[model samples]
Target: MTADGERQVRAILETRTRAFGRRDAATAAAGYDDDLVLYDVVGSFVRRGEDPTGRLERWIASYRTGIGHEIRDLEVTAGADLAFCHFLVRISGTMRDGTEVGMWVRATTCLRRQGDAWTIVHEHASVPFDADTGHAVLRGEL
Candidate 1:
């Protein structure tokens, strides 16, 4: 594993998390490739070659209060031209409907080196589900 490459990927992820907390959709979505493939926990099951910033903007706008977002247990693996990271993300905030929301989601991001920067080519975020109830387990520790 390339230490420098790992650091770069980690920095990108940390910056994105901070941007999300600040509700800066453009900055949060900046790391994604134009042809990004996403398997999100909400909304449609999959998205390909879609503008991520627009979707992020809408999600961020849904929170009436500033969002609280953090990443934990982050693990990164990097090589010359590719890298991947996995982490548990905690999101907490108040929605426009005055509902308090908080959940922990599993996330994995795959990136490709573009010149001197890395861009996320694919991302998957999901929550575990109960076997019997089929309900998502959103709140929990890893």
Candidate 2:
């Protein structure tokens, strides 16, 4: 990875990290492209440019506490105007109904340089599931 490119991309991702920690849907949404496509681990499998901030706001409201995220094994490949990264992230927090959730999910993000800044154009996140039971493994180390 180019040091400068990686540093810039990582900084952009840090906005998301902070957004998740603070439950700031607007901040999280601002880092994405206007026409972003996302495949998230919860609710919708795929979504396209459809009021992501509002969707995130509703999701955050379901949580009693700010969602926690811990990123690991991040790998970034950046070019002059295009970049992509993959990483593992742990999502954990309590729900409004008093349920505690913790899960390890894999994430991939693609970014494109828009003038002086980079914005995420596509993202995919998923949790592994058991083959036999077809149940998501929501609380385990990867």
Candidate 3:
């Protein structure tokens, strides 16, 4: 049962990643619960409820097209009705103004099983910063 839960949670993560890569906001949002809370890398440190959806939309809108995401070093732990996953992700794309954008970020997600489906209840994304300079170290490799 634990193995099954792990697989199901992995599938949900994969689906969400693919949806984001394809810039399909609706499909990406499907993996999250209605009461989802998120700590996003780009905006406010904490966002509650449907705010993550708005953030996602803003990100998608920034790309002219061809947005893509790659996940690395993913680790998942699952029990009967709860799961958690952590991973490093790289997102790359062209901005609407023709600027190239690429970033490597850390991600963590907590999921809850509702019936047979797994939904993200909480998520956090972050990038390390330079402690002395108080600036984001965005160029670091994954």
Candidate 4:
């Protein structure tokens, strides 16, 4: 049997992925801890901020009126209720103004286990891929 902390961290990853896949902002935000931190490749990074709902709203806007994202090569590392996930995201589609575009970014997120629940505390993402190579290169893949 998994310990509570471990289970909570795993749950966060699972729920976060599910929420993102379904474009459910509220559910996605549920994965965050009360003292949450997030790093986004396209948007602003939230540090020591209390509100994660704004990020969720941006995610909603992207799905509703902006680009769409595809996640791949997702790998999560966890110690008890604390965890981090790294992955490559491919974004494509048009902006609300009808400008078509596509891009890819790599990122990692940090999470904490809180009272049988998993919440994200910090996230750091960057576009580290090189055009010289065909695909995205992660920490170990490089």
What tens-digit string does per-residue lDDT give for candidate 1 at 17-89?
A: 7887888999999999998999998889999978899999999999997778788899999999999999988
Q: Write the per-residue lDDT of candidate 4 for residues 61-137, one digit (tens) a residue.
A: 75434345567777766676567777776666655566564666776777766565667778776776658886554
Best by lDDT: 1
TM-score against native, each model: 0.96, 0.93, 0.92, 0.66
State the weakest 10-residue window (summed lDDT) of model 3: 46-55
RMSD per model, one decimal: 1.0, 1.3, 1.6, 5.1
Better of 2 and 4 by TM-score: 2
Determine the C-alpha RMSD for candidate 4 after optimal superposition of all C-alphas.
5.1
Candidate 4: Cα lDDT at 138 = 39
Q: How much does candidate 2 score in TM-score?
A: 0.93
Model 3 residue runs over 4 Å out of place are 51-54
Per-residue lDDT over 1-142 for candidate 3, one digit per residue giving the tens place of the 0 to 100 score: 4989889888887887888778887777888888888888866777786555666788899899857788899999998888999999888889999998788889999999989989999999898989999988767644
Q: List the pairs of residues colliding in candidate 1.
A: none
lDDT of the structure predicted as candidate 2: 0.88
The candidates, ranked best first by lDDT, are: 1, 2, 3, 4
* Predicted candidate 2 versus true structure: per-residue lDDT over 6-109, tens digit per residue: 88899988887899889999997888888899998877778986887898899889999999988899999998889999999888899999999787899999
Give residue 115's error in model 4 in angstroms. 2.8
Lowest summed-lDDT stretch of 10 residues in model 1?
133-142
The TM-score obtained by model 4 is 0.66
Q: Rate the local accuracy (lDDT) of all candidates.
A: 0.91, 0.88, 0.84, 0.64
Clashes of 4: 0
